[model samples]
Target: MQVAPRRTGEWWISPAIPAVANAALASLWAFTAFGGWGEQAFCGVDSAHDPTCATGFENAVLSSLAVVIPAVVIMVSALVLRRVRHYPDRLGMMLTAAAFLWVGAEGIVFLGGYLAQPS
Candidate 1:
């Protein structure tokens, strides 16, 4: 029985969606970018030397939540916001903001790579 906030009457989105989206974007970029589950993950790492599951792991993308964790967080947060916006608990909103900021910061930091669009 929770009601969503009305739009600004100019835009089509709630504005919060973008932050959550950015969180997902950042997470995808971080978790699966560069060499996350790179060639090493699929085919192999070296032809001359076989990967031992410990040597080149250092080169893999480092996310505390592995791969799917961040995505789950973003999705769950979105659902929670849609359902609990009317609740008095501010923790959900705070988490959404924090996730957005984390992603935005990562985007800014790696702007030279992922941020660059193919022109």
Candidate 2:
């Protein structure tokens, strides 16, 4: 028998917290990737090898994975808890997991591309 949720309409809270956390992490990653703290900026979205940007593309990509990976792990864990373990307030879990997974996979791809580029 499945237990009813404790709160009447608070299922949003679980996903909201993770979404906000991911947003914050994304912001930080963007800042670092764009040279927010005196570091050279990475190439822009429209130009992957812009002459003005920094040459350390791999480093920027790696750092972004540092942010994306953890958020993905957390969201995946929450999804597993809600689906397999039958945790409560699971309303937004799937969406949250999907968003995180998409972002994380993109980060991995970006990292791979930079890593494979000629030095």
Candidate 3:
């Protein structure tokens, strides 16, 4: 889960980590779509006639709001849970691991995208 700072000014749940994860996932998800998936459906959201912000996964920067919102929810919820009793420590670690996996896969795709081009 999430752990809030204990009397510290710093936020225990880092936004950067999740932001990076979001970027990676969004990029991978978008690039995979290529010409077909873009402007279609994403995150179970129906995007019809909307391109700029129509649930399209074209760019992570553009999709940051969509990704960050959920991540922040989870982080905040986890932090609240951390304040309460009976919270498992592995939860946060598992999510973090999943994020890493997502980043790794996206990194591979990103590399392929660049290397596949003729420079």
Candidate 4:
């Protein structure tokens, strides 16, 4: 009986990709949580007594986690697949690629929302 050789084309899905993705997501989450972008909007309201603007600002900042949480999950899954033995290489690569794209999309959406808001 002859054993088939494993494919080597999936070398790009290394452990570093997930690790870097995790870091990127963490940084974005921290940036939003700390009001890096939303602070301006929060403070731009002309009326100091109006509560609606403050609430909108709060919601915008909090809503960022909607993207961060799933990105974290995907990052963790990719990391786990990279570490575990006998995990399918193609599946791991696909997950990592998808996660990377998702994170990119999330970042774009976050930026768009921030830019689109009235100052």
Candidate that would win on lDDT: 4
Candidate 2, run of 10 with poorest lDDT: 35-44
Return the lDDT, model 1, position 119.
30
How close to the true structure is residue 108 of candidate 4, measured as C-alpha lDDT? Answer: 54
For 12-53, candidate 1 gives per-residue lDDT tens digits of 334455455656766565554443443234324456333433
Cα TM-score per model: 0.33, 0.34, 0.37, 0.49
- Poorest 10 consecutive residues of model 1 by lDDT? 110-119
How do all the candidates rank in terms of lDDT, highest first?
4, 2, 3, 1
lDDT tens digits, residue span 28-90, model 3: 655554544433333223533344443223453343334444554554454456542133444
Poorly placed runs, candidate 3 (over 4 Å): 1-86
Estimate every model's Cα lDDT from 0 to 1. 0.45, 0.52, 0.46, 0.54
Which residue runs of candidate 2 sit more than 4 Å off their true CA positions?
1-13, 38-53, 62-119
After superposing candidate 4 on the true structure, give the runs of residues whose Cα lies further than 4 Å from its correct spot. Answer: 1-11, 35-37, 41-54, 77-116
| 1-117: candidate 2 lDDT, tens digit per residue | 232355785323455555565566566555655543313323445445454333456455665566566666666665566463364345355446646654674465456445544
> What's the residue-level lDDT of 19 in candidate 4?
51
Which residue pairs come into collision in candidate 2? none
Cα lDDT for residue 55, candidate 2: 48
Ranking by TM-score: 4, 3, 2, 1
